[model samples]
Target chain A: MIGNPQSVAPEPSFRDFSKLCVHTITTKPWSVEEAAEHFAMSGIGGITVWRDALANRNIYQIGQLLRDHNLSIVSLCRGGFFPNLEAAGRQAAIDDNRRAIDEAAELGAPHVVLVCGAVPGQPLTESRKQIRDGIAALMPHAEASGVRLAIEPLHPMYADNRSAINTLGQANDMAEELNSPFVGVAVDVYHLWWDPDLEKEIARCGKNGHLYAFHICDWKTPTLDLLNDRGLMGEGCINVRQIRSWVEAAGFNGFNEVEIFSNRYWAEDQAEFLEKIKHGYLYHS
Target chain B: MIGNPQSVAPEPSFRDFSKLCVHTITTKPWSVEEAAEHFAMSGIGGITVWRDALANRNIYQIGQLLRDHNLSIVSLCRGGFFPNLEAAGRQAAIDDNRRAIDEAAELGAPHVVLVCGAVPGQPLTESRKQIRDGIAALMPHAEASGVRLAIEPLHPMYADNRSAINTLGQANDMAEELNSPFVGVAVDVYHLWWDPDLEKEIARCGKNGHLYAFHICDWKTPTLDLLNDRGLMGEGCINVRQIRSWVEAAGFNGFNEVEIFSNRYWAEDQAEFLEKIKHGYLYHS
Candidate 1:
């Protein structure tokens, strides 16, 4: 027998969607206006909007629409790339992230997911220290805005050029050290599912109330490209239900926000893209 | 002053190699024969042999040469790709690895490095369990040959289709569970240099005396190919000296083998490659 009560339900019903926020990136086919309409149509609990898509509309305009649609922004696109040898460069990154946090707050985002940068012109160890301090510095502004800073630990492959924080445990450590409920971790399945300490760390994050946002995407085995080659849920090799169970077991009741950055999927029609997202949701559920 | 007694020496002489044996892999440019001679010439300590260059020279020949050159074979190129879905395929891999273990014993290798294979058609969590069990089953034969099994946890990038064991902590956990001094881990700087829990894990391994082998290679930014693209010691960003120091500090007096699987270096003249190996010894001393 399957573990989850939801999984035991026979025949996928789109009804009772009182708890499911589908991410906009999953339906990259839809424009910002179209996606907001789609989320309303699907009766999803909420939605996540990307900065690029939001750029088509004014931030204030998008904020107004979400209010009208009764949609909740689980998280804003991102904010932290704070590792550079140059002090000026590092400051600029922090400033940019602060702006992002403000934007997230403006959009009524509960948390601003931070892919806390990489080893910029230095050893990874030193850069990691810089990233830790960077998050600490950003916590005050985030707390004041009522926007929690969710440190999203990217996959270890991105440890060099992307985010040095590669494990949930490491992210939790930073959150615990900050000792602010305002600071926690964004548990992205694509990034953290492979972690052997995942079960232990997720529990720790849950106990600490450090589990901020839950992002979903599958890891394609032949992953041709590092950055953009993400898979649709259940299409690749990830045990999504298993990880979803872990997150849910850890007291997480957030949306399994579908976020795929695939060129193959991106090249498809917007309607087809939305169709695929719906398919992923229905099939996985 | 640094923690070690002679830690202040300029490069080579000041290096605290009390608990480290140096192993040479010619990411620099040397062939297998050339590396064997260099291991003898450098007076550095042990080595781990790759399968490619050794393919031309049979396993028996490899053992004889290691004996002739008076080099300690810290480990054999690797043996675990147990996640293949097909039973015949899985058995084939096991058979090959068994041969690898025998070769390790023939060369007096203290350990056989294992790149625990990846998920075939199942979830990584399941395959990971299979990998651990695979090692456990193979342990009896390994014990008979007097060869320790060193689980080399690959980076998370290789979780699918490569090696499921993607962290030092994971490898240590397997070693601890097996409760055999014969089964342990190989800490390669290229793969594990970015681990945030690395210091604690290294100490843990040291105390367990499970630190079987230490491999060295730099991580290049914009790493073109995941498999073949590795940096030469001092040429790339990783602080090799710092990692070397950490390994030594951890109670391991084993070889710091340089295993660079770079296509660029492989094409270079063997003498030039040998010089760079010597240069790395002195430069990254």
Candidate 2:
């Protein structure tokens, strides 16, 4: 297929926010209550709450508050980091994940996204095994709480400490190995837009019923920070609409979750940033 | 083999610099003549000349100078950036690569390591195609000059503007598809340590006679820059010794090329840095 002409379809026009979802971390300045109120007022359809946003709050009441605004609760922000050098640390990670799952269930979210962890000096092969084992340990609690776990394979830049699962193929492989409806993969564009096998892997996951969630963001050319330098949908090099088309073609018809982590955007007036997001969504996503 | 135990063999002790090769850019501060003097004084075996390091000098004489110093001209630093929005731009890149081949031939280097390029905002698939075509177009020239081309897949973080080939597996696929004896893949630990299929792909390339070069460096836990900020061998999390075992097991009996681009190291005294490189090679690599 060298030099063969391959082109994704043109961007689809989004006429409404009926399927739009905003991650609370995308606007880090906002509290969960504030985000819910603003997102609801802005006609956004969904909200994916970061676990930190639920700090010291009544989880059920927060779920009710979001529902009262007619917002569908998407997946919780994060729930994995299972790899550790010590057995006690790994067990602690599992326990924390269980708590995250319980919180997700209480918040009436359907799933919890996992940033499967990696230890700095540990071999990635070993870290991956631990991630799988940790997920297996949490499967019973997850099933009981009716909360799915979406494995979010991070970018390779994060392989040192953030995640051992750095490609969608790896995530799909793990999800299939786990073999549970409650265990699936979350397709995050920031982590996966660079992958050559992304389209094929997306199709595979969709066919196997493991495509559970989709996260949207752009990859800034000069990505300044490994953690917080993500661009808005249309502001960077990622062809977000094209990836979304691939996801939709692969049978994913869920919220187009906007999950950006940008210090620049956070420093801005969040209401204005949210407006830009809405515009970016309507035009770029 | 989802959760299989993969124990790489123990690190082999290096007693000499017989197979040690350092890229000129790794020292950055040293001129080619200065580098030759320092390397020869340190009893280093080989040197990979970055194109910029050869500016304003007679290429053939530079080769002879290095030969007089008893240094093997390992390979030319780089020669690929094939992807461009304009056909004219791609042609310019191909022409530039041809010039690189000529330079390598004149410099008595056996090969040119290609950091195959990607255009920002262009689809990576397109960039990859351009890279393949660019290499194909240069095959006759490369053959005529008796020089090889080594496809060096960069890290995914550089996939935006550096190279679309982000994994050794992808580079292997490209090299196999090109099917030219003059074209092979370079295994760089800095670029590929995160890949799950790395060992298998290395083995495949070795069996197919496509493993041409092996570049060594460590990935820092907090990689500060996308272009620079690489760690010395044992200073970071990369299991350089383990990867070296895999490369050796795959039948690679070539130079353990130390190719680090670090602003931190570059700022240090060049002579002091050379000493550290020697230690890093003998111990960490």
Q: What stretches of model 2 exceed 4 Å from their correct place?
A: A1-14, B1-14
| Candidate 2 clash pair list | none
What would the per-residue lDDT of candidate 1 be over residues B136-183, giving only the tens digit for each residue?
878888888888888999988888778888889888988999988689
What local lDDT score does residue A201 receive in model 1, on the 0 to 100 scale?
93
Model 1, position A131: C-alpha lDDT score: 83
Q: Residues A132-249, candidate 2, lDDT per residue (tens digit)?
A: 9999999999999999999999999999999999999999999999999899999999889999899999999999989999999898888888888999887888988889999999
Clashing pairs in 1: A29-A270, B9-B14, B19-B252, B19-B253, B20-B253, B21-B254, B21-B255
Determine the C-alpha RMSD for candidate 2 after optimal superposition of all C-alphas: 4.4
Cα lDDT, all candidates: 0.77, 0.91
List the candidate 1 regions with Cα displacement exceeding 4 Å. Answer: A1-31, A37-45, A68-70, A121-129, B1-47, B52-58, B69-72, B84-93, B121-125, B267-274
lDDT of candidate 2 over B133-167, digit per residue (tens) = 99999999999999999999998989999999999
